[model samples]
Target: MSLRWRLNLLIAGLNLGFLLVLAWLLVNNHRESIREEIEAAHRVTVQMLGTAAQTSSVFGPPDTVMVAFLQSVGRVRANEIRLIGTDGRLLFGSPPSEYKAGRTAPAWFAELMRPTLDATVIALPGARVEVVPDPSRAILDAWDRMVLIVLVGIGFVALLHTALLYALRHLLQPTEADARRLVATTRELAQNREVTRLIHAGVEDERKRLARELHDELGQSVTAIRLVAATIERGGALPVSQGAARIDAIAASMYDSVHRIVRELRPAALEQQDLRAALLDMAREWQLHHPAIEFEMHLEGDLADLGEEPTLAVFRSVQEALTNVAKHAAARQVALAVVRGDAGLDVAISDDGRAGAASLGGSGRGLGGMRERIMALGGRLEAGELPDGGFRVAIHVPMPEGAP
Candidate 1:
């Protein structure tokens, strides 16, 4: 269940349970109170009747007058009054039983309170008197008050529930907004990454094209100048030959410098082959230059779906990472692996190079640029030091959907 549903259910269930328990206690308590009131009222009324009869009999007259007075007492009470003679045969009034008009409360309510009614018998002036407290009147009043109180309580609880639900919805509104904002931000980042990737790829193409042009145009001119100088030196006088030799030496040096510049500008492997082949060749070239380092090259899955720009981005990122490792890491072994997946490509370059703390991007502009380049291509770059004293760089570039 969602948090909203769970919390609402929990709070609602607890409230309902507590209210039910409270109502149960209240009803029972009200029943007991009404019974007590009836009992107290009966005691007071019976005492008054006894007082009236005793005071009248002592102060008034003889037996004949006493009989008349007893009859008067029975008439005044109007319910039941008994005057038993000495023989227990002739009496001033009927037995003490009263008839009620109708039910004061519902029959069920009366029944519920009947079990707890108290029966009290008392000695009277001239006879035995008994009073059984009937709580019908009080029960009716108590039920009315209780019903009103319960109704008000129920209404209050309903209102409170409604308010709480509203408040809960209001509280979650900001969370909903935050979720929407996060989605938009993520979309913007992806777009920015794609733009950066394309830009970096274009830059690579320019670099390769410039290198090829310089190598073809400037290299041929220098070589031709050297040939001309060599031809003049073989045919001229001793002084002329010495001057020709100087020109030839200058031309040869220029040619060698230009060749080195071209190689530095663009690797032949990348310009001439597929990304995987280019990376393997580059790895071999690095290993050849630093024979002390053990370089492992592992490739998995297909790279045919990746366009030229994405290909260039990945290759350059790997190339820069390797260069940084060779220049700064001071490590003996390097592990480089590329795995293509349905979503994207993953490249990991790890080396046992960190002397103390592991850090990302190394300590130069080169590492920073590599990170930017990768990110611009809608990829991520992460680097850290391993626990066993090594640094690892990881790159992930998201591929387009449904690419083979």
Candidate 2:
């Protein structure tokens, strides 16, 4: 069931339980009250008849005087009186009660409320007087009162349930609006991630094209220039040879610069689809350039089969982190670790740098880009200042299904 219906059911159950308990209490109280009322009335009637029986002998013959007295007294409330003669013939009986005379409470209600009381008997000289307790009228009164209370209680509980339902609907309105807004936000975020992933793919494709062009076109052209200069140097003319040597050296330098740019655009290790080898190559190059700083790397698990997208995302994140460390951290030591487990791949790059050095500089954009890249790969990236005066970047990328 929906939450609203579940809440409604719960409230209904509670109200129903309350009504049952209220009815039970009302029945118990009324039953006891009726019992007490009948008992008291019955006691008074018995006493009066017994006293009258004792004094009847003074008036005349006991049975005749008692019958005359009973006729004079007529009906007593909540009690029945009868006189028996010496020959076992009925001499007198109390008249039936006229108060609610023709009506009685339901049989079930009467049985529940009926009190147990002993019939009182008084012996006369030639007969006997019997006073039996009667509680029907009292029970009928209690039943009437209980019916009224139950009707009122049911109405009150129904009204209470209606009010609570209204209040719950009113309270849930804002929650419904918030849920819609959350759904919209989630959709927008997913679209943005898709766009980011497409953009990253396009950029990598462009880089690969540029690297291939520079290597095939510009690199070969530079080699041709070097060959021509070598031919001129073989001529053995001092001035021409010197000029050719300078040209050769410049072409050689330009060739080296082009190769470096191509490597940066698309590393050979990545072209071979080996992320571990790419990371190691990058680290070795970084250490070569920044010989003053200490660089460390640790790799575990099978990095070769992580697919191009995740491998590229991790590679770019580490690359950006290391560049940021070189430019901003000014630290003595840097450590990079990449591990793959059953869940996914994890990469961490940390540097022992000045506190908050990475964030203080223009590193936010780079870090943000790296985070977006990782997120697009169904992963997450976290970069922050470490507690002991350093900076760290951590990235995780989930493995695609059936990946080795």
Candidate 3:
């Protein structure tokens, strides 16, 4: 349920409970009041009749005089007076009350409010008087009063509920505004990711072009210089031959350096879109150069078919991590692992180097760029110091939907 409805229900329940408790209290109070009133009226009626009976017995026929007196007294409030003869026949009975005579409260309500009282019997010379308590009028009064109270209580609760709902709606307006702002922010983030992806593609294209230029232009030029210098060294005088030989050696070194830079700029394996091959080749190159540091790599699942974007993201992230490790992590061991699962790709690169050596704390452009690339592919990158004085970089890239 929504917050509004839940709170509304809560308030409604509380109001209902309050109404019930109020009714209960009112019923009890009215019941007690009716009991006291009826008891008092019965006592007064009995005492007066008894006194009249004693006076009639002294001066005249007690039964006749008492009946005459009762007739004069008429119906009593909340009491019924009856004179019974020796043959068990009622000689006189009080008349029914005229106030609310035809109507009575419901049985359930009357039972709830009715008070218990015993009849008072007084002996006469040849007859008897019986006073029975009646509480119908009082019960009817309580019922009418209760009906009014309930109506009022219900109205008040309804107004309170409406007021609370209006106030809650006003208070929750900010939450709706926040929801709108969140949606806008999410759209902006998606746009930013698209921009980052485009930038990455442009960067890769530029790298490919630079690598081609260096390999074709600079590399061929250096090779041609080496050929010309070799020719001069074979035919010139001893001093001239020595100079040509030096030039040929320098040209050869330049050629080799150009080829290395070309390879670094655009690896052949990446050109084939084979992430596994690229990672293996890069690890082999690192192991060859840094033989003193033990380099370990573990590969799992098929990584050759990943789309170009995610493949590049994972490869560059690992490449930057390894570069950092070599430059700062003066450790004896490094491990790199990549796994393709049902849901996505996972990569972990760890080095048993001094903690805090690689500056993975968002201070370096290398790590920041890596994060951008990974995030563009809807992936995450985490770099932190291990518990045992080492650093680890973990990356996760979700598999694109509907891809094999």
- lDDT for each candidate structure: 0.70, 0.84, 0.85
Q: Name the candidate that leads on TM-score.
A: 3
Number of the top lDDT candidate: 3
What CA RMSD would you report for each candidate? 15.2, 14.0, 15.3
lDDT of 3 at 18: 92
Query: lDDT by residue for model 2 over 14-132, one digit each (tens)?
Result: 99999999988988888788778888988898889889988999999989998989999999988888898878888998888889889999999899888888888888899988888
Which pairs clash in the backbone of model 3?
Answer: none
The ten-residue window of minimal lDDT in model 2 covers: 355-364
- What order do candidates take by TM-score, descending? 3, 2, 1
Question: Which of candidates 2 and 3 is the stronger one according to lDDT?
Answer: 3
Per-residue lDDT over 328-391 for candidate 1, one digit per residue giving the tens place of the 0 to 100 score: 7899899999999877999999998864453454443455566677777888888777779877
TM-score of each: 0.41, 0.52, 0.54
Candidate 2 at residue 192, lDDT? 85
